[model samples]
Target: MRVGIAILSYKRCDITRHTIEQVQRHTKADHELIVVDDGSPDNTQNMLEELGVAYIRGPNCGVVWNKNRAIYYLHEMRHCDVVILLEEDTFPMEDGWEQAWIDGAKRWGHVNLAPSHWPLNDRIGGTGTVSNPIISRYVTGQCCSFSREALSVVGYLDTRFRGYGHAHVEHTTRFLRAGWGGYIKSGRDHNFYLIRSPLKVTCLDKPPPVADYSKNGDVFNSIRHDHIHRWCWRDEEEMAVFHTSFSTLSRSGIPVPTISKRQWFLSDNTDQNLVWDPETQVVISTPDKKDERPRVIATVSGETVQFKVLRDQTFWMTWEQPGEALLKEKRSEAATFKLIYGKNGGVGFFYNGLFLCTDHNFNDHIVLSRPEMKNWEVFHFSGFSDLEQPNNNPMRSDRIQDWPL
Candidate 1:
């Protein structure tokens, strides 16, 4: 399917840069990206141009209007079969994630690509080949894919709505009202994992102009707001956590076989035997083998929440905890960790699978600033997958000669 990505960006250049670069980097299918800049006073246009991004600078119309303009640009102007709508703040976690939503849009009508596990799946269940179903009543537009057929029926988002409150919801309601079905691909899936950008980072030097939330709320209430969406999932708040394996985050996309049912001791002198369950992604402190279950000391995602092991010796991963907390707990005071592969070929301890920098020295301790094939980050996998950058030699003989697991 011919997919098009439409980003409605006002400011926040750093976030927008990541959004665009990552999307362009991972997308393998035929697609185009059009960033609609809603006339930001900041150097948004210049920044996008410098990055070789194609953007349209529209008038300082509110968020809703800018979104409508983007839909028109993608669906009507470009004649794309599907348009993937992304807000500047919504970030994707997996590579080639758009392919799933694109496939979903062909089967379902409107696909909410970024829905967290809020409304239950059974609320609007499926009739397609894939298991993930479409929500018939409610949908959000953020990080969503609209089929050309779906847009032809629902039309553009209502330009009457002033700001950023319920344009997504109102547009969704119109689709359902028009006898079309809406689906939400929740972030809980491994392949479709997406998360909101961390709020702590100061991306922009100055605060750019943004619509007032209270005013947006006032506008939403002032209009036709009593749309009945059959409520199935009624969670108060939705938490987003990264779902892909650590190795996948690397620029090279190293394939690490999921470790399971093995007792692995840390390379350090500490007698810490890490027994990791690949399916559960959990580790317990040396199973007591007593009547009482072993407490879950840590998880592959790095959550340190202490809970009793279930009958299957697994614990439920809670979304309430942040993934960053888990990574930090795993790091601890040790600057490095060597995840040794047991009796599994030449697989050894690998560095954290984040982007690597070419200019800097090889330091396994820090997550690098950007993507490059400069550093040698290795870990052991039992079987073999094709190396993404086999020709780019980052491994130094001097550094890895003493490969002790």
Candidate 2:
């Protein structure tokens, strides 16, 4: 599929230049990259000319408007099938990132991916852990993908969410409602590498301000106030936890499976050997002869959770919660689980999966709960079949070494 990328920059010319360079080196598909300079005083125009990317120079429009403008120019004017949006500071990890997203789009019709965002130490907002196949109400524009159909239906980022907070959330909600599936990829990190020019590191002592566009009677706030019954997922008590894993079998290649219902018990007495073979792509849970078999359940594929023992002997869980089901289930699908390493992890439900409302500590063991359901039955699946290994592992050391930093 023909893909396009849009990079929005307010005044961070240096960061924009670096981001463009990284994208050029890493993008593997035939695609167009548009850089929108929102009336910056810096030498952004000169940098774009030097880089030779499709450049749009406009007045000092706010973030929402500039983003919408870029979409209009690229999608409406240039006529691309898909658009990959990025901020001036965000960078892709490798050359095949675009292909991965394109592949996802081809399979699911609509998708959005994001990097992990860890709050600075001592910051009020909890440290952010990335989710795989994220079903959030909104995704950060730092790096995301949108199918042409999605943009055509959802229109653009609501300019009323001018400052920062609720705009992306509002736009994403509309997209989800319009039958778009959101995804956050795993095994990669969108690190906060630099805050080049104009954006600098201040004291990491205080929390970032929560943008309150809701108070101004924006679309997001209107829905929040007027639609009380539709907002039943807002309650905390109605929540459940979903978990899953992705593995590759030896003869088989990479198999993404959902963990079905299974109980697991760890005895206090003996040492259990948990094996994670990258070559085999199999995670084996072989306990000493005496310990109880932890009954752990997972779905093999398609919107189910999976649980497995990682290389470090810690348990890892990931799953995709269907946006439709989340909305129907008034209860939230939120829960905390103890990591294999004993760290805490969990995602809070907001308006179903349309938005990830909060992050909670999972160190303390908590019960698994389900969100309130209206009419749909929760999807369940059997374990995955063995996968076939490819002649060459696309994820190789040489390829990794060559990727732009």
Candidate 3:
């Protein structure tokens, strides 16, 4: 039978690589492995290319849509008999691990190969030697398998669940309601080991940095029992969070009405952005938006944030002068700033306890003209995130590529 394996990956590059490499080296199943990347701003795209596997990298479209991308591609486009879904954190164990899942899917139509199981098979070293039935209404998306019949009847994941949490549960519940039989419990045998990796710094804009489960949970609870999905997922508040996640600011970007003296706001290309010349390593004073400029990147560790100017396709320098904002090629020249968050989903760059500002007025140049976390000092990073970048792209073909199936 033709097998299609889809792996869902987020911001963790090291863990993703470790998972994919394990699957590649151990599994002997005749399957096309496809990694679905949720527009990670890291080297995830670069890592996938080095692995020489098929992948689709798109913007932060939530966990529901992320899984659906792989499901739709593997099941609908590739016409695989059985499709296996895996997350980046799970590692495949032993050789030909796909056979048990294939056999299970062939028998049950759909099955969830539970990754985080009981203590018996929790750690390393367990062949999925035996198979047992899991009496569950829905299956988890961590590591699962589905037959063509299941895909044909159930379709892709319910995107109404939005980014994360209850999406998998709701989708599998629908399948079970349609008589897909009991989900698989990997028997006493475990195919994959779920490893918890450290969360690194990421530019995540979906499911929120810290997911508000109540909203999506209410969504799942509301429509879970309906035989048919005729109801729309958008309420006014839900739509704001669903469509443009940053439209509603998180508590971290909470309202600080007290210190906000001037009005801080989101920046776009329409804003008077600082244009840097790569050759001169200086910020161009020109107001023209058409001119080419190097990408300005920022990194955060602990409570300190450092800025870098991407030149010659490499991070070559730091902001040398606070007043002129000159990019200088020296690590020592790097300026560290503390984030003074504002009410309107922005932050004021507090360098050495002073706000980087423009004299409490929209000036042609930014200067160290403020001392507090006010409007003139505040600038939003969420406005310039990849969450809006790839999602705003009108073409799906631009983000997806044809890989060897």
Q: Write the per-residue lDDT of candidate 2 for residues 50-138, one digit (tens) a residue.
A: 76666665444356656775676567656778876777777765666676566545544445443445223432221222223433323
By TM-score, who's the top model here? 3
Candidate that scores best on lDDT: 3
- Count backbone clashes in candidate 3: 2
Q: Which candidate, 1 or 3, has the higher TM-score?
A: 3
Candidate 3 per-residue lDDT, tens place, 283-353, comes to: 43334545556544444432245566555643433432345565556656777775443433344566765
> What does the lDDT read for residue 22 in candidate 3?
84
Candidate 1 TM-score to native = 0.45
Model 2: runs farther than 4 Å from truth? 118-132, 136-138, 182-219, 223-405
lDDT of 1 at 278: 43
Give Cα-based local distance difference scores for all models.
0.45, 0.43, 0.54
TM-score of 3: 0.50
- State model 1's lDDT: 0.45
The number of clashing residue pairs in model 1 is 5
Model 1: per-residue Cα lDDT over 165-228, one tens digit each? 6666666655555444442235211112122211122233545336555555565556544433
Screening candidate 1 with a backbone cut-off below 3 angstroms (N, C-alpha, C), the clashing residue pairs are 134-183, 302-326, 347-380, 348-380, 350-378
